[model samples]
Target: MAVSLGFASGAIVQEFYVDDDVDRSIRDSVEAETGQALVDVDYGDVVDGAIVWWRAEDAEEEDLADVLVDAMSNLDDGGLIWVLIPKAGRPNSVRVGDVEEAAGIAGLHATTSTALGQNWAGVRLTARPRSRR
Candidate 1:
């Protein structure tokens, strides 16, 4: 079996796994739920992932963030996960910085940049070790 990792957002801690397809089903589900398009980046074998962005909703960002964190935690074989919440001035305008911050809030280590390429990029957060405490 693959190594399991512990993930957290605020008070929640859950197990996670890294899959072969890098959690494509999560992307598809998010797309179907939000009716948004997703983009994939070439991390060149060193990494494999995708990004899903959509128009902002009346829902609070914190609520959405919680949903995203829980989704990542529950996703089958999911390790590297990124959730972006950019300004809602336009559709699919999730800035890399926004995603980075959300990843951070999810207690994930990440790096991002719009200059990297495309409107979106793959997830940067990977499975992290559980706290000793």
Candidate 2:
């Protein structure tokens, strides 16, 4: 998962912010593969990427937008934010449209969606291009 996320051992610490509710197995896999520990929400430094666990039942569009914005605020320019939501048929699963709408509000766009784990699906989000007004 670390390699897939483009992480590698380097002189600089490659930090990835982890939002709440993500499975411990996923975090373990990443940590074991990257030889680095994932940082939590309280991390004060900029991150190379982020993994955000979200549930539709727990939030509204505005809530998700806020979370996404805050999660990416300390991210690097080229950083990727992976939003992990419950899979279809799973409890609290989120619709793709809801994710896209919230991402748009957060000044981001969804580039891809994939199965992140047995119970979770993931959407990769990147910053939207700014208009040079």
Candidate 3:
């Protein structure tokens, strides 16, 4: 799990809105593998990496876009941002297309995606480079 999530020793990672089960699994995996604890933070807190777990049906598309914008605001340069959603065909699962569209609206691109676990899948994103004046 840590390897897939790209968690590293001493890397600052934060989680937002992830379920307890998933969060515990990730935290324990990271600690066990890297011997480091992730720095968990709420929305609006800046950090080097972040994980956002949300059920697509829970919020409107616009709301999800806002959440992504806020999450991006808190990410550092060259940082990783992970968006985890319920797998397709699962109850209340979010569509991959919706997630990708929201990411584009937030000025990000989906670099990779993988199955997170039995119940969820993850999409990896990185901030778009800023345009110079």
Tens digit per residue, CA lDDT, model 3, 49-125: 77778786557543777778877776777788888888899867888778788889888888898887677888888
Q: At residue 96, give the lDDT of candidate 1.
A: 51
Number of colliding residue pairs in each model: 0, 0, 0
Indicate the TM-score of model 2: 0.79
Q: Order the numbered candidates by lDDT, best leading.
A: 3, 2, 1
What C-alpha lDDT, on a 0 to 100 scale, does residue 21 get in candidate 2? Answer: 57
Per-candidate TM-scores read 0.39, 0.79, 0.80
Positional deviation of residue 46's Cα in model 2 after best superposition, in angstroms: 0.9
Give the 10-residue window scoring lowest on summed lDDT in candidate 3: 36-45
Per-residue lDDT of candidate 1, residues 1-133 (tens digit) = 1211122221122212222423355444444543434333322222222333422341334343454465454433333454433333444445555555656676666643322122223344554554465
What is the total number of backbone clashes in candidate 3?
A: 0
All predictions: root-mean-square deviation over Cα?
12.6, 3.8, 2.8
- In model 3, the runs with Cα more than 4 Å from the true position are 1-3, 21-23, 31-36, 40-45, 60-62, 131-133
